[model samples]
Structures are given as structure tokens and as C-alpha cells.
Target: MSFVLLVTLTVIEIVLLVLVLAIMVTMVTRQLRSIAANLARVAFGVRAVETQVSAIGPGVTEVNRLLRDINGTLPRVAQRAEQLAR
Candidate 1:
């Protein structure tokens, strides 16, 4: 009788452990899907930022070129102004 009772209890414990593991697997799968979706959204956002930066690149280069041209002319203009004053 004691042996029968021990066997029954052991079977029940195994069944419960299996149920717990199934539940844990289901929960982990759900969380992984959510994490994947979030990562995809982040990837999309990063791509958008990259596109905007690319679009700005030529405009920024043009502005820098203009600034360099103006910087090159400033000393000549100042020298002319001083000559006029003299």
C-alpha cells in the first residue's frame, strides 16, 4: 500500500511539472514575439533617421562651401576698405 501511494504521488508531481513547463514555454514565446516586433520598429526608426541625414548631407556640404568662399574673400575686402580709407 505504501508503495502504491508513493507511485501515485510521483506521477502527479511529474504531470504538474510538465504543465508548469508548458506554461513557461508559452509565456516565453509570447514575450519573444513582442520583443521581435519592438526591434523591428526600432530598425524602421533608425532607417528613417538615416534617410533624413542623407537628405541633409548635400545641403550641409553646400553651406560649408559657401562659408569657405566667404571666408576667403573677407581679408581682401578688409584690405580694400583700408585702402579706400587711406
Candidate 2:
């Protein structure tokens, strides 16, 4: 009788362990799905930012070229000012 009781308890323990493992796996799967959804949102935002930056690139280059032209004329303007002062 004691042997039979021991066997029954062992089977119950195994069944409980299996249930615990299944619950843990389910929780992990839910968290992974949540992470995947958030990552997709982040990717979309990054693409939008990239598009805005690309649109600005040509304007920035034009501004830089204009500034360079202004800088080239400054030295001659300074020389003319010195001559006038004399």
C-alpha cells in the first residue's frame, strides 16, 4: 500500500511541473510579441525622420554655397575699407 501511494505522489509532482513550465512559456511568448510591436513602431518613426532629413539636404547645401561666396568677397571688402580710411 505504501508503494502505491508513493507512485501516485510522484506522478502528481511530474504533472505539476509540466503545468508550471507551460505557464512560463506562455508568459514569455506574450512579452516577445509586445516587444516586436514596439520595435515596428520605432522603425516607422525612423523612416519618417529619414525622409525629412533627405528633403533638407539640398537646401542645406545651397545655403553652404551662398555662405562660401559671401566669405570670398569679405577680404576684398575689407581692403576697400582700408583704402577709404587712408
Candidate 3:
């Protein structure tokens, strides 16, 4: 009789432990998925910034080249105009 009682109690304890462990594992997996989703969002933002920067490159290059050309000839042109006026 005592042996039967001990066996039943041990089985009940094992069942409760398994239930608690299962709940804990489920909670951990859910948190990990949430973290992964947040990281994916951050990666998407970085890619968008990269694409926008690349899109602006051609316009920026054109502006820089235009400034360089104007700078190289504007002073000489101004001197020629002054000489002609005099």
C-alpha cells in the first residue's frame, strides 16, 4: 500500500514538472521570434537608406562637375570682358 502511494505521487510530480517546462519553452520561443522580427525591420530601414543614397549619386555628380567647369573659366571670362570694355 505504501509503495503504491509513493509511485502515484512520483508520477504526479513528474507530470507537473513537464507541464512547467513546456510553458517555459513556449514563452522563450515566442520572445525569440519577436526579436527576429524587430531585427528584420531594422535591416529593411538600412537597405532603404542605402537605395536612396545611391539614387542621389548621379545628380550630385552632375552638380559637382558643373561647379568645377564654371569655376575654371569664369575668372578668365570676367578679365576678357573687362579688357574689351576698356
TM-scores vs. true structure, each candidate: 0.66, 0.67, 0.60
Candidate 2, residue 71: Cα displacement in angstroms equals 7.9
lDDT of 3 by residue, 1-86 (tens): 69999999999999999999999999999999999999999999999999989989999999999999999999999999999999
Ranking by TM-score: 2, 1, 3
- Clashes (backbone N, CA, C under 3 Å), per candidate, total 0, 0, 0
Kindly give the stretch of ten consecutive residues in candidate 1 with the minimal lDDT sum: 51-60
**What TM-score does model 3 achieve against the real structure?**
0.60
Candidates' C-alpha lDDT: 0.98, 0.98, 0.98
Q: Write the per-residue lDDT of candidate 2 for residues 8-78, one digit (tens) a residue.
A: 99999999999999999999999999999999999999999999899899899999999999999999999
Give candidate 3 misplaced runs (Cα > 4 Å). Answer: 55-86
Compose the digit string of candidate 1's lDDT tens values, residues 1-86: 69999999999999999999999999999999999999999999999999889988989989999999999999999999999999
Task: Give candidate 1's TM-score.
Answer: 0.66
The residue pairs in collision within model 2 are none
User: In lDDT terms, how accurate is model 2?
Assistant: 0.98
